[model samples]
Target: MAAESGKIDPMHQFLVEPLFGQHLVVGGYDISFTNSALWMVLTLGVLWVFMLGGMKRELVPGRWQAAVESLTGFVGNMMDANIGPKGKAFTPYVFSLFMFILFANILGMLPIGVVGLHAFTVTSHLTVTGVLAVLSFSIVLIVGFAKHKLHFFSLFVPHGTPVVMIPLIFLVELLSFLVRPFSLGLRLFVAMTAGHILLKVLAGFVINGLNAGPGIAAIVSIPSFVLMIGITLLELLVCAIQAYVFALLTSLYLNDAINLH
Candidate 1:
């Protein structure tokens, strides 16, 4: 049974099969297609359709237009609430980040089995999350330096500390800043990865129990199906919350950089 289970390897259900090999033998550079890339493209395509469909100016709004407007308004409000008046200039960056993340997350929830291909949750990967965090960090660093020049380094210093306490406070502040990217990436990756793994394990139990016997299986399957439904709904909420948290933290970081407080 263990061997059979190993052969089945439920985790391999999300593995990406390469579509291309190394272009130059010496360089060993390979460009391969991946499930994550497919989902990202799908998300971008969906976003393009929605945004384009709603681009027309009309006296009365259609459903797509309403959705676009609502999403825009929500992001706008979030920027206002989090970053204040200075955030107005950051609206484009924040909105783009929110939409990309939101769509990537929503696309992960689709039932890809019907399409005869396994779906990988892109956000579950530390590499993907790390890239996003690093991008946000770069934006903060660049914008801060551009705006304040050398004075931006003052972010590491606190205003109200005694001379003796300044070193300790500065050390704490510097460490906190250094950990931002790791924390941001890990939080999203862990949440999505854990949720998907839990769902997969529960699903395996359901499948195994159903193969046991009709009477016992039926009793077990009922609760399994109910749990699956509950988990699916929870996953939907998790997707949104993770994206919002990421964008919210990013806005906060940007605010910190701009205001230096």
Candidate 2:
């Protein structure tokens, strides 16, 4: 069935087809408004409004304020649970990561067709996720260095280990640290890409089945349509889960830096 419609390009949803290209004699980069940039800006806009609106603290909290408070508390509690008392200082960083991803995922799920444009899945692209992972990794490294000074290198050398095994342990530890960003970024990119592909495939099935025949087509299409709706809801939950998982892992990494545990 998938072959009948031709092989669908999973990357098509992430392609940032440039609206225009800029030329410069010395050097230049693409300046055209791409779908990725569009969705990113939209996500930022939503985040700004949600956060700002909620900060206007009132004696009786409004819906927006309550929502913001809930998010804040959620992150705060997560940090405390994961990193103990030392985790309090890391709240801002974790909160920002969570909110950015949450907003991006939710914005992508919106009915963007009303604007006469296709919805772009920014999170599905490895470049974007890799950049975010790198940013988190940098934070972990910098904070560890600043807080622990040169002793931060001890992270790669376990304590209470036999001297003979120290070299092998260090090698394993170093590789694990190096792969943090790749793992974090790939997990998110793969999940988003796979989910979007499934959604597109199911949607195609519904359309093709409807065109095949009135009776048989309708029967098959009904289940496909139902599955599509179910997947849509599941996608929403996945979006939140991915965001939370990213933030949770980030916090855990930071905890290792701060507490050395």
Each prediction's TM-score against the native?
Answer: 0.91, 0.90
> What root-mean-square deviation over C-alphas does model 2 reach?
2.8
The 10-residue segment of model 2 with minimum total lDDT is 1-10
| Tens-digit per-residue lDDT, 96-209, candidate 1 | 888888788777777775666556677888888999999999999998999999998789888877888888888999899989999999999889888877777666667777
Error of 1 at 156 (Å): 2.2
Estimate, for each residue in 154-241, the C-alpha lDDT of model 2 and write its tens digit: 8988889899999999899989999999999999989888988888787666776777788856788789889989999999999999
Lowest summed lDDT across 10 adjacent residues in model 1 is found at 1-10
Clashes of each: 0, 0
Alpha-carbon local distance difference test for all models? 0.81, 0.85
Clashing pairs in 2: none
For candidate 1, the per-residue lDDT at 90 reads 92
